[model samples]
Target: MSETFSDDLIASLPVLRRFALSLCKRGDLADDLVQITAERAFKSRDSYDPATRLDAWLFRILRNAWIDMTRRQKTQGSQIDVVDNPELISIDGRDVVESKISLNQTEEALTNLPDDQRAVLLLVCVEGLSYAEAADTLDVPKGTIMSRLARGRVALAKQLGIKS
Candidate 1:
């Protein structure tokens, strides 16, 4: 791969971090996951097919790494305590009281979702990927993505006491 390709991958770090944060729900853990994902992506760079979407490839790597880490943690009988970072919670120039309440509710709702449902919702709704693109990223069928997204949305709405 050319230097340009490496730069492009580097440019994706912020989005990767955001996705990681959504998955892990902890800033510190999300940063670590991003680092691991970057290292793995670099080591496996030669395996990357230029014909495929780079973001999708990197996302798959990150998701797989998180899965492995979760499995290891489970086997070890260890639990990670989620630490809330004030910086991560602050929304600049927004209505502080109302926005914070809404944000907290949304975050709580998201956390309540199953991993599979949350992954599809984050990829499609938060990351602005299309259903097909999200399906490709998660290695699921488009129909599966649609169903998960639908269920996730309904669940989130119910949690927020919104009428579906």
Candidate 2:
């Protein structure tokens, strides 16, 4: 509605894109997700609680959209790979190449997790939401989120060849 609102939405794009990529693993799909998120947030702007974290709200919308898309496509597996393009590997000035390597490894590990565990892990660990916050976003009890996070971490460690 205002310049500030537009600015905030623009600032959130990168993280939203990254999160969408984690879910969809396709650049085009992730981009479409980001666009859908932006549009939903705009249309339902009045529903946003001023005191609540906008990022969390937007993430909830993105997660719902991802689920809806999955249902529509009847995805048999959780992971979705993007087209192989050299450009997706292009690092910008702010990227740490070594860290990116680690991130790739982590993504692979994440892919090995059950979809439920992966969603909880990403919302809490990668998205930096508190357990309660993540629980709220996923519409589960706090205890459920905690247990899923714990189990997800254990599963990730195993998948990554790290001892738990």
Candidate 3:
């Protein structure tokens, strides 16, 4: 790989992990997904088109890997909770706790969304992909992406008790 391509791949890691976490919900699983995505991207670099965005290509690969993985394993009902770390505690303990609580609530709400809607929301809203890019990444039509995004926004707002 060229140095620039290698650096771009490295820079994309954090965003890749965020999207992986949204898909898998478990940190370890998300890490594995990111690893698989990087490996696949490296091995398939010759197939990449310079015309398209690298990040979008990587997202498509990660989503495919997640699909393949789910087909191989059965998901359990047990959910893992984030353990409190003392290092995170601040001088204003109440404020820290409130922030953590709010974050957890938002995560829980996201976890409750249907997979398609959540994926659409994360790609467009969280990852800052344009609707057409999101559609291409997800292998769906642009109109489908738009409708899913609208429904997802409405559903998420309702869940968070935000007026829409």
TM-score of each: 0.48, 0.45, 0.45
lDDT of 2 by residue, 1-164 (tens): 46666788889999999999999999999999999999988888877786887789889999988876775465344543445554455556566877888789999889989988999988876666667668878999999999998999998988778986
Q: Quote model 2's TM-score.
A: 0.45
**Model 2 local distance difference test score:** 0.84
What are the candidates' C-alpha RMSDs? 14.0, 14.3, 13.4
Q: How well does candidate 1 match the true structure in TM-score terms? A: 0.48
Stretches of candidate 2 above 4 Å error?
A: 75-164
Clash count, candidate 3:
0
- Ten-residue segment with the worst summed lDDT in candidate 2? 75-84
Q: How do the residues 37-131 of candidate 3 rate in per-residue lDDT, one tens digit apiece?
A: 99999988989887899999999999988886774454333444436455654488898899999889888999999999999999987776667
Whole-model lDDT values for every prediction: 0.87, 0.84, 0.88
Work out how many backbone clashes candidate 2 has. 0
How well is each residue in 36-106 modelled by candidate 1, as lDDT tens digits?
A: 99998988898999999999999999998788667556556744444644444545665887888899989
Off by over 4 Å in 3: 75-164
Q: Clash pairs of candidate 3?
A: none
